[model samples]
Target: MTAAILADALTQKVHQTEIDKELQALKEQAMVSGTEDSILVNKRQGAADLLGSLRLPHKRDEEWQFTDLSELKAIDFVAAGKVSLDVAAAENFYLPEAHQSRLVFINGFFTPELSNTNDLPSAITCQSWTNLAAHQREQLANYLGQKTDGNEVFSNLNTAGMTDSGVVWIPANIELKSPIHLLFLTVVDPTPIMVQPRLLVVVENNAQVTIAESYGAITTNCTDRPQQQPYFNNIVSEIYLGENAQVTHIRNQRDSGDSFHIATTAIAQGKQSRYQLIDVNLGAKLSRHNLQMAQRGEGTQTEFLALTTLAGRQVSDTHSTIALNHPHGVTNQLHKCIVDEYAQAVFSGKVLVPQAAQLTNAQQLNRNLVLSSKARINTKPELQITADNVKCSHGATISQLEADEVFYLRSRGLNDYDARHLLIDAFAGEILDQIPLASLQGRLRQCISCRTI
Candidate 1:
């Protein structure tokens, strides 16, 4: 009996390792991949240690109760550090509006030759962290990894192995005439790859700028076989707006269907600032986005709009939070999801108004349209307000394409597919029209219309 008990104890110890062996391998990779004596070494090491000490969240966790990570447990992924890409293959993915002001990263490492920064104004600074000098990196030490908390485990994992980073700093009182775009493209490799992309956008007081971050792959045919393994993309974006700054941010993700994407956007708004966000998701076998924003000062205006379009057996989850801590705060948010076939989607949004946040006007709405009977949607809109003088409202709606509307379109010389596509396009156009760039808006409309079920 004593011998059996000792054997069981040893087995349990191995089973209870904080992170899986796959993640442990990544931690080891972080230790040896980057420069050893750089200014960011300590920060990377600290995040690595934190990642090593904590376990990945499971379905039992309240925040992740609706999403499952069991499928991720089946694969072994190696860190994709300092990899190269074919420039010709990556040329088509760059957006035209940001042609002269863009940064491109291949396999999470910034590619200088493919990026264009020659036309940027003197007041604006746009460069990859990999190309910065030691002193320049030191100047950024105080701002890096400062806004996120311990609850962001995936972000910590990303920081542990992240070697490529992009930075956009706008000087005070300077407004950029064009937007800056960050494009990250992943290529397939024989071994399963894990890529981490980090970005920091800082707009100084009285400055204004438009920024966009996009993630995708060179090809969309990664297989599960050992020779053509899948990939995982973990991205984190930190946007800081100084007092009176007006910023417009856009996030676009269209990865391969065989990939896994986990992204987080943390925004900090200063006094009397205005921040707007447009989030679009189109492809991924499994994807989750955590959007957190804080109104730290009075008279701030915040707006968030998200649209997710999925088909086949895809699964997508979006969780957002708006924390108003000051008086006279205002916010508006709207999220929409379009699911077809056997796909599933989840939307959870929360608005927090503390006692000090009197006279806050906030509204949250979630709308979902399911085309197939097998599709599933789980939505929750919550408002936690402690202020007596606040005007807050939250609601959700789940519905399908009405047959009568389809029939009306069909009678007007449109086929079944065209009719269905028209309805879906109208549904998505509400958010797509919010985009200021005509090129991007047209591209989104074409993508939605072509992917019609």
Candidate 2:
């Protein structure tokens, strides 16, 4: 019995030793891609240590109760540090001249070689955030991570590895005549590429700008086989809208189906500012998006929308939070999810109004259309309002394809499968149509239409 106990104790120690080595490897990567920000490093190290303590999720953590990450833990994925891409490979993302300010990142590092700026409008200056003028960087550091408290483990990791990320600044009162188009390329797939997209948009008072961001993969890697089972795409986005600044933002993700994607986007909008955010997710095996926004100024307006279509064994989870700390602030959010096959989906939204925030207007609507009964969707909408004068509402609905809608389409001479697909497309149209850029709108619509039962 003493010998057996010693053997077991030794096994446990060896296992822990391997885990610590793995975490240290991740930390070394952060040190290699150095960021001058000391605060970011301290926070990142703390987060890494904390996450190392918790076991990988297994459908138990309340926030991640629905999606299962078992497949990711089973494989050994390589860390993808830096990559390169040519200009021609980015043809799929062709934004018109009217909205064609470009910022390109190849393998999470800003690549000037893959970017185009000749056709950019004179009013909008297109350049890498890392190369920003000295004054701009100082001003940006003030509000860089202010909106996000590093609430999640993933955000802290990205914060520590911030050297590769970029920023976009629309100086105060500079109305961008066109929408800025930012692109990130993830090549070197088979080796389990890890891509981190970092972004910050500062729209100062009376500044008006529109941004369209998209991601794509360039290389297919079979060099490492199954060990590279789970590729990582970790993205962090921060947007700051000053008083009376009107900004519209859109993000599109079309990545490898085997990829594991986790993203956090936090926005801060000032008084009387109007900001709208739209997220389009059509890829990834296990994907989650954290959308958190805060309204600090009065009379601010925000519109948030998301549209996702899942199939096969894919899973997508979206957690959104809208906090109103000031009086007379307004926010509206809507999420539409479509799941098929044996896939699962989840949507959680929380709206808060503090006692000091009187006359706040907030509402959340979550709708899901499950094509197969086996395909599941879970939605939790929570509201916490401490202000007696606040007006807040939240509602969630989950249903399958309506027979009548399919029948009406079938009456138009379409097959049952075609009819079902058409109705689902229509349901997602409302959210995709919210994209102001015509190219972006059409591309998102096409992605939605290509979904299969």
The candidate that wins on TM-score is 1
Instruction: Give lDDT tens digits, candidate 2, residues 207-284.
Output: 998888887666453211122345777788888899999988888877667777888888998999999988888877
lDDT of 1 by residue, 55-156 (tens): 667889988888887776556666675667777787767778888899998888888888997768966779977666677678777777777656577887
Name the regions of candidate 2 deviating beyond 4 angstroms.
1-58, 97-100, 118-125, 219-229
Model 1 ranges with Cα > 4 A deviation: 1-38, 220-229
Each model's C-alpha lDDT?
0.80, 0.72
Q: Return the top candidate by lDDT.
A: 1
The superposed Cα distance between candidate 1 and the true structure at residue 62, in angstroms, equals 1.4
